[model samples]
Target chain A: MHTDLVAALDIGGTKIAGALVDGHGRILLRAQRATPAQEDGDTVMRAVEDVLGELTVSPLWSGARAVGIGSAGPVDASAGTVSPVNVPGWRGYPLVEGVRRATGGLPVELIGDGVAITAAEHWQGAARGHDNALCMVVSTGVGGGLVLNGQLHPGPTGNAGHIGHISVDLDGDACPCGSRGCVERIASGPNIARRALDAGWRPGPDGDTTAAAVGEAARAGDPVAVASFERAAQALAAGIAATATLVEIDIAVIGGGVAKAGEVLFAPLRRALADYATLSFVQRLTVAPALMGTDAGLVGAAAAALTRRNSATAAGV
Target chain B: MHTDLVAALDIGGTKIAGALVDGHGRILLRAQRATPAQEDGDTVMRAVEDVLGELTVSPLWSGARAVGIGSAGPVDASAGTVSPVNVPGWRGYPLVEGVRRATGGLPVELIGDGVAITAAEHWQGAARGHDNALCMVVSTGVGGGLVLNGQLHPGPTGNAGHIGHISVDLDGDACPCGSRGCVERIASGPNIARRALDAGWRPGPDGDTTAAAVGEAARAGDPVAVASFERAAQALAAGIAATATLVEIDIAVIGGGVAKAGEVLFAPLRRALADYATLSFVQRLTVAPALMGTDAGLVGAAAAALTRRNSATAAGV
Candidate 1:
């Protein structure tokens, strides 16, 4: 039996994951290696190469048509390079060329991790069937991607939907991104927990200062914790609303660690969304929890691969 | 010599302007009528019909193949209707259908005025060669449209790129649209004037308290006036930067009344843009004054018509 497949790679600060994905998005085979992110650029490339090596040795690898890599951004898809902040060694790294060589010259498609997740969500998760959507990951830092006019909008650099860096508070705190009051600065897990701590909310006897602890405190009716989460929700709502206004997306699917706050985050988010997304066209904008889970990055990379393959076929490549 | 042409309509609160535009975007003929904006829906429709009537009576009318309308938004291209805030008489008006019937069954394409301006700018103005751009009209009210992947992105309802309503100051003043700290709420012409006046910058002997007056004062080194324009520039910069961040546009073309403030607006805008567009990809974003002028709406409408006609022809419709 012959089956077409794509080699997918999800490269982040913590790990390098690769998979052979079938057309229906099923993972036929997988390999992973812990990323030596703090090491030199060659060390990181070695980790990615190891993952590809494992996939290449598989018998199913013969069915793979192309390679797709969804790596932590900011990635330059136009230049086939990446300079992820967390992976300091990979600045302006020629990742696509490296991956192409490792994969024996197969065609490659590269997108930011946020865009990849959006591709996965749009293809098989919360944003399925919706022609226009904004998919976001609100964890350590808020990141996002847009699905405009029913196609993934990875812009020229494959970093189009980097919503976290967009300023929601022009006169507020200065962000590490050099912008003022960016969404991630206000809504990320660390920011939420920090805001809670700064506002006098003490964590439980477990002394856990993570956003998860803050979320538990919020659920328990701690005023400061609740306020911090609400503030994060407000910022998130503002960013989401701004996105909908700019591009006419109808849904925003949020995932990552902070979204784990559940109703404590969602309730205020919806309320703030009402106030911000007040335009008739955007008033109906809805937010949903992301459904692709941990495998989203690999699945999304595969989705990008399939999309590129299909487009190439359509172009008679 | 016979040539294929399209009829274009630019509908607004004060006037209904119509033109017979050729494939090359030249206005071969034009007609206009004052809008009976305060009248009933039928009356406003009659005004639009009158403008169309003049164009229909023209000897060159036979060459017209379709009608393109760029109307004050929010227009619903998907529903073929409009509900512009200024034209209160026309709420959910069947504008596309009305134009289709008035033009004797010519196919009609409806788009928001901002989108129309964007088309004009992309086709023959400042954003001509840019593949991804945001064209803004910062006047009595701020409005905008987008060009993504070298095509107009009108979204489903013809109201994408409505940047005026997106909040940059989330906890700031409430906008009439029910959003807080919207770019328009702070950066529109009236807002600029109001901010200047509020800061105690009195008008000259002419007592003209317009944004233009503020611009003159700003140019004359009035600190309050300069501060006001700078503030507006800050908000506009934030919105523009946010747009670029979300969509990866390389340029922002600003047009309309406030833009006439010239360097008073542009100088500070460029400075503020640098502060907000901090990301590597977005760092190169450039802001330019729109070049299409007052005829931008009509020309843009024609551009949309031509684009739609070409697509339809390609699709063999």
Candidate 2:
């Protein structure tokens, strides 16, 4: 049985991204649709169908044999349902069944969006051929995936590497995930801006309030912006240290928008990690940007489909 | 090619423990000796040799084939040397060589004491057959080891699961490792007592206090003791929650005499873990007691030696 083309979709609270990727780990065609913010499960399902329709009819996916979906938090892969916290009306929705129906039963698979990114990066991105790697998306929010022993750890419900909530400080800011001082609450884009704003640091007479602006200001030597970035970097470094200390990772490939702050963030991160001197095993941590960019989600989603590409060809479902 | 008898030595800050362990994970003979606090390198080596001499001549080590040494921090396994912080006289000491000469050149292996304990638990104790586990000794200090994908994770120097130094609270106590708010300084045996003493609770009429006596008081309904255990539990829960969220550990087997507090500690731990409701991945955290007790170090040392046993046989070195 030959399998080449596969449909991939990345589901988030803000947007839903879809693509047609072939066996070569290349996205042949792509499309995006805004998440129907307050829409019910059926409405989101329709969005998925519309996106897939754009791909299946395109020349790229005309020969595609299977589909894969990567979604936000707390996915039950075995049951093919998702209970994403950010997206309303998405409690225990049968996500795989919806995609299967959209593709006319072309064998769809589901995985946590973070897990998908990890698998994609492991298979084709910077961390390829490395058995133990931590894939993190430091974007609008932090998300992660674990590749240990050359296989992905999906945990009890495919939520193994939700490292955004890993505590950097117990007395830290309260995270949306009902925890305090999670890395997300301190380092995510919005959090960076929030911290700077809370610190009463204004970039100029006119405030362009946001993490992107904070990054720009920090680059331009805005004290508050710089401090916020340092704080986030320190927290990120601590978490990275703990991760390295525990997992003994060879390299930490950091993706996501906030990473764009670049050296302003990495310098402090390196310093804080150095302060974790007592741990000798993982002190030799190598930090790098993820090779894959915006399309990591789509690529990761596609990798998940390809892993089961054979099943799509076998039962001819 | 048969392997059975081996000498196991545990080097701690206050004392040095040695034992003769058989193939069945049983200690055939054992002894504990005081560590020479102000001794030089040669002096400590002589002390180690004296202990080895007793083990080899005993009934247990009459047929011993090798030696396993589990020592305090900062070890270079490849170089067969140790830089123990507790044994200041032994900086860059050739521990493997010392034990070899003492045992008359029988094969010798050395590992981080924490790693040895972790391996011991996995091989014959609480973490049996479980490929993923973390064993923590929450005594006067907290130290740990990770077993992921069925292999012990000893960071570059075999000190991987050093959770004691992992920062939990930014405002928490300053750890001896130079980190601020480490779990060790917040929840460890002595920390529990110290925090309680500061809270105006006399552990006893005379303050020759220890974590064990505190546990006894709590068991006997001393409110101060109960509160101290709760604080420690809360801190541990936060730390454990962060770890569970990051690594997706299947079980956390806590050892050390401090864990004898039992429900006094675990109850608050479960409550604090529930506060992380935003994180769906770590909800099913299970806290269990360590099974090997004080023998953990000896058994772990033995298991660590056995890992080298196969390699030694294969290399014919």
DockQ top scorer: 1
TM-score list, all predictions: 0.99, 0.84
Candidate 2 collision pairs: A177-B278, A281-B156
Candidate 1 local lDDT, A91-189, one digit each (tens): 999999999999999999999999999999999999999999999999999999999999999999999999999999999999999999999999999
The worst-scoring run of ten residues by lDDT in candidate 2 chain A lies at A276-285
Error of 1 at A299 (Å): 0.7
lDDT of 2 by residue, A1-317 (tens): 22577888999888999988877788778888998958888998888788988887875555887788889877888678998887778888998888887787888778898888887888888778876778888878988887766666655567777778888777667777788888888889888998899898775666688787898888898888999998888778777767766656666778888887788777777787777544655666677778887788788878877766665457684
**Candidate closest to the true structure, highest TM-score:** 1
Q: What is the lDDT, from 0 to 100, of the residue B177 in candidate 2?
A: 77
Candidate 2 local distance difference test against the native: 0.79
lDDT of 1 by residue, B1-317 (tens): 54679999999999999999998889999999998989999999999999999999999999999888999999999999999898898999998888888989998999999999999999999999999999999999999999999999999999999999999999999999999999999999999999998989999999999999999999999999999999999999999999999999999999999999899999999999999999999998999999997889999999999899999998999
lDDT per residue as tens, model 2, B262-290? 87777777787677534655665677888
- In candidate 1 the C-alpha lDDT for residue A248 amounts to 98
